[model samples]
Target: MVFLAPKKNLFNLYFLRYKFIFLTIGLLFVYILLNGDIRSNINVRKCFSDINVQNKIEDILLSERKPRKGKTIFFHETSCNIPDTLNHVRLKARQACAIESAALTNPNLDIYVLFASPKILNNQTITPILESILSYPNVYLRNVNLWSYAADTPIYEWFKDGKLFKSKYIYSHVSDFLRYLTLWHWGGTYLDLDVVMMKTIENIPPNFAGAESIYHVAAGVLNFDWDGFGHEIADMCLRNFQTHFDGYDWGKNGPGVITRTLHEICKTKQIYLMTRSRCFNFNVFQNETFYAVPYTHWKYFFDSDYLERTLEMTKNSIAIHVWNRYSSDTPIIVGSNVAYGVIAEKFCPKVYKSSGKYF
Candidate 1:
């Protein structure tokens, strides 16, 4: 009787163990089937991983630049860890370079380049470009160290506490914040590196606030009034940055946030948003019929075939933006050729007679 009882107990225990193993296996299989290959991808995992301020800035600084060779332009990607499935960084770099080249054409202008990099030591290749740009009277390079304050915080704590944020959010927030700050301290224009200046922007009226279109406040180019409203706008942007801790989609949200805030403040203060005849590009509400130019006007600015066609259509545009379709192999040679020809023939006749340098 005792032997029979022991065998029965062992059999029941073995059966229960097998059942539990099978149940666990079934649940795991179901999870994998439902989630696809998501668990296997490390990039997705890293996006949600805890990151410290120093580490975050380090990643942003280390992101690959296109051409692997050449002057590093005035723009740096925010380290948002958004999947680079489509090579978005390459596109941004190309667009930035195009803007830099275009901005360099004006002799009287000063180009200010802003970026956040982990490494404090200046890059060798970028040094020459900075030196070259600085040769002109007004160009300046400013590196804003974003991680200086929270360097000692742990990665996990920083992420959870909102001390660490994605790069895009930081960049957009900082840009808007700095724009207002600069105006409050010393007034000047805040030009998005994406914009190309077709005329002397120095002539922008002191009281004027520039916008691309009325419906869309083209943040790419802003000439602030720098008195009452400008100060308020800067303060609001800074406050939002400290509070939101996310939502930094530059293409969509950055300008939208600024415009909405500015509009609200303007209403309360009884300050009307001004619409200039030809000074700004984004104003859509002007009574006088104005021309709306495509961003491709800047992209194809240097392509001989495209330039010829564009010149025939509108010979005098102050600026054009190349929004997308930017790449390292962007036809700079072709574009520069057209630019030189146009500058010599129309805008600045002395371009050829001066330094006569070609990149």
Candidate 2:
């Protein structure tokens, strides 16, 4: 009889032979799953200059006609590492709620929700949340190219040199820069994605930003028209951003830039005095107008016990900055007695109802 040799375990033999490779691939796969995107910091760096990259934005300065009625309200969605998973264009419930609140409250005011990438718009899928947001005739979703956006602006060189991706808070810093650039170019209202519009803001001062506190003037809700005082404020912000840009520090480039500009323009160290426009014409609204619930107590919006008190506190607020930095991880249960839920139900009923059990 022929010698019957036991069959070698080819799979185990191969695995053992390339165990290091397998381990590396396994770790990489796990990382992608955990991080939701596999692109490295290097890829982010490449994308900053990659014009061929599919994600792009339309030049609103060229395409969109100036609104004939109320001034345009702007909201920016910036993501450097966009995952290929479902449509990123589909706004999160919270984001949709925020947009819908603004759209519903200010029907006459043109609301532009600009995305940093075009992938979401290019996708064939139109998600429910997206449909709800688009239902508002005043609401428009457009893609924006950073290079094109920064072009003709003071920060153009900074972006051309690829310094934006170096920031630890890349998304926030890019947004901080874009807000000033867009406001400088078009002169409009810029609202943070985390804010919920409680009332119409079209009647508010043309160039205004709310103070998060006595010491800090938040950039979350900013309005700077393209000409006159608003133009002056936007110009100053662009100069300040270019003159003193810090990538490492979180707030330095954002609220810090605006705070510093306001200080210089108003010629005062104390921000509380800016509320009265003591030194300059730029209107600095009290914290209650936008930051009714300060960042330190942002959790109050999510707490059922504080729902009534928070609502009562923000009754006169034109908008509420939910301080997404502090309260994003906290869930807002649908139909719950939380301030966020109640506010969403009243202001963004469509988004709130579509959020199912949890928002």
Question: What does the lDDT come to for candidate 2?
Answer: 0.79
Best by lDDT: 2
User: Residue-wise lDDT of candidate 2 within 89-139, one digit each (tens)?
Assistant: 667899888899999998878898876644345545667777788788988
TM-score of 2: 0.83
Predicted candidate 1 versus true structure: per-residue lDDT over 1-359, tens digit per residue: 45455888999999999999999999999998656534333443344333343212223223342111111113333333444321111223333343344345544544545443322223333443333334454444443344432233222233344433334345455454444434433344555554444565555444233334545444444444444544445456445444444544553444554555455544422222433333232122221111234443544555677766655544454554444324224434312646424633333222222322432
Assess candidate 1 and give its TM-score to the true structure: 0.52
Show model 1 residue runs off by greater than 4 Å.
Answer: 1-110, 118-128, 147-164, 167-186, 207-214, 239-250, 265-292, 295-304, 312-315, 324-329, 334-359
- In model 2, where is the ten-residue run with the lowest total lDDT? 48-57
Off by over 4 Å in 2: 1-42, 45-70, 83-88, 122-124, 275-277
Clashing residue pairs for model 1: 198-318, 212-281, 212-282, 212-283, 213-282, 213-283, 214-282, 214-283, 214-284, 302-335
State each model's CA lDDT, in order: 0.41, 0.79
